[model samples]
Target: MSEYDDDFAEQGQAVYEALLARTGEAAPQPRLEPTRRVLDLLGDPQRAFPIIHLTGTNGKTSTSRLIESILRAYGLRTGLFTSPHLVSFNERIVLDGEPISNEALARNWDDIRPYVEMVDAELAEAGNEPLTFFEVLTVLAYASFADAPIDVGVIEVGMGGEWDSTNVADAQIAVFTPIDLDHVARLGSTIAEIARTKAGIIKPAATVVTAAQHPDALAEIRKAAERDEAVVIAQDVDFELTADHVAVGGQVISVRGRAGEYTDLYLPLYGDHQGQNAAVAIAVVETFLGDGSQPLGNDPLVEGLSEVTSPGRLQLVGIEPTVLVDAAHNPHGARSLAAALDKYFDFAETVFVLGVLGDKDAEGILSVLAPIAARIHITASSSSRSIPVDELAERAAAITVPGLVHAFDSAEDAVFAAREWANEGTSRLVVVTGSVVLAGEILDLAEAEEWKKA
Candidate 1:
């Protein structure tokens, strides 16, 4: 699609390596100054297109993808940026509902390299660390969208909203997936605090779409909306997932949108939370394209939702023992993953391959998963932050039956063991969960071995 040759995997790999070398997203900079400066020098590319920004504790990626897909179905040129890729860095930045080509990625990075360095120089000159990994990527995403000259953009924040690099631009519309206690060390120790912090993305007069929240969390968002005079279309009020039942390939749902009701929409993703996510996504599109008084035509709505996929979220990546992977690194996410499994599958038992990060609530995750897991296979993922399997297993064993907890040094070994255990019977399933890095690693391993072809 460009002047460059098609063999650009090498270029993509180089870009990924360079990004990994930067101050990583794990070490988030709690300010947007560096990102602002970078964008300022790059002619503020974020201003080149309208945006629908999303932030929350979970479901943001799925919701963003839904909105982007719906827009593309309507024949709109769209750009989407989400975080914590499952397999490749290129997955994070999408154009026209597809991952940006490696050639385009390399070309965009080169075009903005000088300005990124300029911002890095300014920060270093002030005795500060250079831009953290996500900051630079945020700039790259915005710049790429400007070059693509997209009609709209759907951007998901990498973490807490107030100081996240992606907050540098004011979105025309802001969406929040459910907010829960997460990133307590960085955002805050309470739901209200985290809600307020994430609510920072709601710009003045921007229409806000949100899920039902804890009372205190709702108050914080409402307060922010009043301050900004933004309109809040909330779940169970402005919109709702009226019904969802298990169906082939995934599930079918009926959503009452802001202005209209959409029913029998077959979403390829599982779980009730995803149903609610689809509802919010539909509202966002309704607000974007038309009033709530009329719903989207059946063709685009059905086709988009039917084709939608939330990779690494309850995704069945292997067969024979039914290996599934989900990027449910937090307690809330773990709960959703567990519920989806129970609601969608009739497996008599399940073996879990879990590896949690250091900062996450391991006990909280185990508390939810251990109750349903037939056995626990603990292992270490590629992240430096992954908890040791021995330590993780000790914690997991306390919740699961004695002699049911096992440990492996690597994710591949853990998957192997889990699959072997699952093969004991057809009613058994193996699920890999707990961290984004672990999910990505498992997918990578599965592909290398020709495990299931996704």
Candidate 2:
């Protein structure tokens, strides 16, 4: 723990322990009614804050972070609620551009714990199991934001948007980042089907910003927005990314264009796809600020993306032997990761540390990632959804590649194994990718190790 963590570590641990004891099982399937009951009991705190709802298969977290930073830069006290936090649960909830402090978190839990208990009692009375882990977390986030008295909240959907617990909020702006085939079991098998599922967050009369390029995705979203009469802004049509170039230092940088041009804009994220993400973020901010209700101007836009930082989204953590951590779970995200690795770190003999949830299309993702990886390190992430380490190893072994493939029980072991396999003094690149839960655990472990050193 840092000095800051040292000060509040006990309180934080207590709160986390309480939360863990209350909701221990992390089930994949989510029911809506328990969450609905919890929010209703809390008097719907989600409605108290203005919301920007974002849903998609990829770039949701990064886009949500960008939106939060931009909104905060505009001088508004902002609350950001994203999922599968890389380091801490507090990382999932940010107020005024900062992670909710342990002190504040304890206080909020104290205030909300009663409500949580009441909801649990009510659910029991209704002959139902208690609220699931995510439902409670969503309720906690809303309560935290409400207690903070934020001007606006940027919320990212955990899975498919419809019936998602986060979709409980009334959003003034809805963002859809590149939808693709990922969750076929729950969402759908085809792009159009998944697009329809994700389009559920676009409230009537709200402004919708999307980076969907597929005809199926665009058509589905367009129809949904048209039916709702929502104003829709899309990439390559309303706005665009221009002048993208990577510096020798490996920063994937670019400029965005709205009605006019955004010059010298630098996003520390990698991949050509991030240009679209930045563009979508800029468009969403422009719309929200121009709404005349909450005026966020160009200064915030310039400062926010320029200074913004996030972990495990094409994040390069170490030098010499370049090590990157990206939580690209789905095929769309895998393609983007593969492209980024090809573009910026192509010179290095790349080793990919890979794993996936059982529900995800692991083979499809591997197909996208295999071309760029000179070696593959397969490992099981620390989630119930995780595919077994042996299963992952089997999949990697099946792939026809001219490189090494190995599996391990944990991501750390895989990391170490990759490092050992890397060419001597060649500046080899090791990328930890696959499931978000896996990536987040690896990131948390890495950060904890770094903290110990400090």
Candidate 3:
């Protein structure tokens, strides 16, 4: 690598370490004042551009990326900010479809560090905790996007919608993707409670686009929109996924968008849920660009969906023995992964390398996956919050046959053993899943160890 690249890497790492020194994402502060304070000092960069804000239990990142891709296809410079990046910190921030350059990330961090410190002092004096990792990161993203002067910002909520750090921005378009029970601890236990928390993103007179939701969740969202007098365009109602067929790399889908019907769109992503997300994204774009009345040009729609990619969501990383990685951390996401595996692949036997965070429902995830897994190698990711391997194995054994469960101290060892087991069979597949952190680790290992070359 060139000296410039090396210097950029170093500076980026420094910024990451500085952010790590603050409170982490797992224990996010459920207040927006700190973020709003920093933004106020930064001239409210979030207000500089109109935002398309998204919040839900699942598919938020993919839906956010889909919206950004379609907007970029329409020749608009877009800014995308999503949470808990699979690989790099830079992955969380995208400018015009590319991960922010390391130089730009460092420069933006430097520019905002002083204001962040000022907020920290104010909070300290007020007997409150300073800004968190997510809070500061949100400030940096808004500042960077304002500096870029993006045409629109596609911002995903860091946690629940109402008080989430990203919610400080008044979005012109509010999007929802399949509300379910995931973060029961922080958000809420029931679907209704969770949906109410998520519905906090809806702004006054905004255009709301939602995927098909459970009755309780849908009711909460409708109530919020009604209060705000926002127009609600819902899936299976105003818009729908008319048809989806399994294809070579992904699937071909037809969506009846709010403005028009889009047919024969080649989306290079797996799962029926993704087709639903595409429908929602199309509606969001339709609402954003034309108040849900004008049809998007066919070229932009086709090209946008064709190029859309959601990495670590049923992503294929290896050949010959065929290895895949998915970031399905919760049961809701795991159910989608299992369904996609059944519909998309023809494997006779499947070996799983499963690791989960402590807060996640390991039993729920295993219940969904164990029915399809030939053997599950239990392990933990490098995250401090990861469940211990032995504890997870015990839980898995209760859900499935004891003979079908194996434990390992590390993800790498578990994956090595799972790959070896899969290699012995003709139509066997290997999958790494259960946590986004584990997915990111295996993805990095896949690149470093050249898993594809095998």
Q: Among these predicted structures, which one has the highest TM-score? A: 3
Q: Write the residue-wise lDDT of candidate 2 on 161-184 in tens digits.
A: 887888878898989998888778
Q: Each candidate: what lDDT? A: 0.89, 0.79, 0.93
- Give every collision pair in model 3: none
RMSD in Å for all candidates: 1.7, 2.8, 1.2
Candidate 3 whole-model C-alpha lDDT, 0 to 1: 0.93
- For candidate 2, list the clashing residue pairs, or say none: none
lDDT of 3 by residue, 198-303 (tens): 9999999998899999999999999999999998989999999999999999999999888898998999999998998999999999999999889999999898
Model 1 earns a TM-score of 0.97
Q: In model 3, how large is the Cα lDDT of residue 402? A: 64
Highest lDDT model number: 3
Over 4 Å off in model 2, which ranges? 1-7, 21-31, 248-259, 292-298, 423-425, 444-454
Off by over 4 Å in 3: 1-5
After superposition, candidate 1 runs with Cα above 4 Å error: 1-6, 291-293
- Compute the lDDT for candidate 2: 0.79
Q: What is the TM-score of each candidate against the true structure?
A: 0.97, 0.91, 0.99
> Residue by residue across 1-454, what tens digits does model 1's lDDT show?
3335369878877777877889888789899888998899888999999999999999999999999999899889999999989887889999997788898899999988899888789888999999888998999999999999899999999999989999999898899989998889999999999999999999999998888888988899999999999988888988888999999878899988877778888999888889989999999999888845677888998888887888899988898878889999899999899888889988999999999999999999988988888888999898899999889988888877898788999888899989888887779999999999999999888878777843
